[model samples]
Target: MTALDSFAPAWQIAEAVKSGTVRAEDVTRDALDRIKSLNPKVNAFTDVTAERALTEARRVDAERDAGKKLGPLAGAPIAAKNLFDIAGVTTRAGSKINRDLPAAAEDAELLKRLHAAGAVLLGALNMGEYAYDFTGENAHDGACRNPHDTTRMAGGSSSGSGSAVAAGLAPLTLGSDTNGSIRVPSSFCGVFGLKPTYGRLTRHGTFPFCDSLDHLGPLARSVRDLALSYDVMQGPDPRDHACADRPADPTFETLTDGVAGIKIARLGGFFSTDGMPEAASAVQSVAKALDTTGTVEVEGVEAGRAAAFIITNCESARLHLPNLKTRPDDFDPDTRDRFLAGALLPASWYIRALQVRHWYRENFAKLFQDVDVLLAPATPFPAPLIGQRTIEIRGEEILTRPNIGLFTQPISAIGLPVCTVPVFNSGMPIAVQVISAPWREDLCLRVAAHLESEGIVAAQPPSHL
Candidate 1:
């Protein structure tokens, strides 16, 4: 294995730094080298803050020697989705309209926590323009390619975060999930992603695509690393009204307890019907490994997904109306027309969608009363070929790539805590969404650990790097 493959987790890296076996400067230097060599091919990063990373590493190393308390993630390297503000950096939510926007005055709150935890910010990663789409095809900043297969798409708007982690550009990356941004990319790129429950983390300083439904989250290679980041980033931020005062999540440190006796179900109906067969097989392996029985039915998914669309399009239109109206030419042509159209959705639809969201949440709540977790396909198909639209599912033809998350958006619309686990399949990567009740990320990770122990987790690249 290469130096990168044998790379330690963030926590272990901190311990190594503390023990003097590995210097923070050395690790940061190696990380910068890796990004330089790998990121160009992937277009995973918009900028590379090498000078700053090295300076920060030297500072942390000095503080450690002076007996300063090192936070849990100290000296660990991380990448932030471009939407998060880093001092003097433009907070572009991946749009040209914001190209002329001035740099932020302060670090985004989430970035602040990560900095406080001692994580070195490598640079800002690329993403879907204004986070308005899911396919990861950016007109201005080239497409973010899937590392597993360069020609296939890396699901977005967290496109850069997914590609960066998959390509070993960074160990942990922050991504926003207004809908399926975080989970989709994690699934497609064969990484672990968590979309925390609504208000679980601060959105302050993170550019919001939609004021009501936006979410910021982490994407990492391992479940433990992802969970560790989540634990540190969560807490009440009076600055964000949606921010919650909830207690901490059970650290993934305890995930080894396993999912034995954990009641789980494979969602049928909307989840099972009309999607890629490989996707079903991937989830089936996890079910069989966990001794889960046949799929359970989930009704009203179409209605739920429709409601989610209404809410997303309406809110997004309002957020960008000024840009869409004055600088229409500035938007990515791929999503510009859709943005213009969204400007016309009636307020009645948006409000009714919220009502539908409430009803769906209640239904999900009742379903959880019987099952510990619900399992559903993360995408209708494996990451589709770059720019390829039509997909064959079972037998019927469908617009495979963009609508792959038809099922995911609804879950996010209600702000459910979700963890997308990569399923080891032979073709392009596939995964299953394991969703737990609100604020129950612990349950989601425990279930993921069970699948991991059974060898049903992401299929690692052969040791060829």
Candidate 2:
């Protein structure tokens, strides 16, 4: 690997810039060059902010030259999912309809925060249409190919966030997860992704998916990068009412505390079944590494997933009601039908779903009382072929797109923090979810970092990249 390749980790890049070992301009230019060479094959980046990135890099260099104190992510080149509003760029939430909308007045809240921490914005990455997909196939923008195997799917709606990080296009990228958007892609692309507890980060300026379930977090190659980005983005924002009013809870300080004395358990029952052998083995490997054979079952997990589906449909439909009435033709057919069905959902069903959600949350909170972290497969299996629809899981045929989030939905339903750590196999990479109670992201990161330290879980970028 070249010197530039050594900077693939955001933390390393930041430290290098901070110590005057490398200029931020050089780092930014190297990243942009990589994007130019590799993006066509991976389709990870939808936009490349070359000019803005150079400008920011030069500013960072100037600060360093003047001997000013730098931020934690100083000089890191990062990107955001296209859903985020970038100033002077039209926010296309993977749809053709939003292409004509006026450019954003300013950067999104998270982008502003990252910028304040001295992270340079590279550009916007591609995602599923309106953040409504599990596969990274965009009808308007085109499919985001997996870096591991270009013919395979990169799980979405945060498709490009995973692809970019895996391809080494950017060390850190922000993705919004309403269901498994963040985790699924991380699994498929062989990278680490954080889907922080809902409301942990402000959602102000991003395109809405499911307001109740929407969460914005980071995708990176290392546990420390995830913690660094997450710490930089945490804060209260009046713009997003859902954002927690709590002060920043930094995880970097405690990331290497180790998992000793922490009770970790594997999620059994529904999670153990209806998945390929690879998925089961991934979780088992993580469980074995943690030396925890104890199992905990979250009752009504299937029902919880069903409830999440109902809520996602209803909320997403509500957000697009006006557009659904005016330009339904502009949406991806799969997204359109789902939204239509959601719009037609009975009020009774929606209300009951909400009630069930609360009940599930209560039960999940109880589960955390005994266990500090829970382990589960991030996806039912590795990435399916790009265009293939059905997947055979233990002799049962299941539709590929919807079922990919089967394991993730139930956990995200109650808004718990989850860190998806990539687990490599002989074939493709799968991921295991390290879940913790709400607001206890520290615990999740701690466990994930421990696993990384042991070399049991690590990010393996594609050789072709």
Candidate-wise lDDT, in order: 0.81, 0.92
Give the local distance difference test score of model 1: 0.81
Off by over 4 Å in 2: 273-275
TM-score of decoy 2: 0.98
Error of 1 at 90 (Å): 0.8
Winner by TM-score: 2
lDDT of 1 by residue, 350-391 (tens): 899888888877777888888888888887777888898788
lDDT at 334, model 2: 94
Q: 362-459, model 2: which lDDT tens digit per residue? A: 98889888889999999988999999899898898889999999889998899999999999875799999999999999999999999999998998
Q: Candidate 2 clash total?
A: 0
Off by over 4 Å in 1: 1-7, 273-275, 462-465
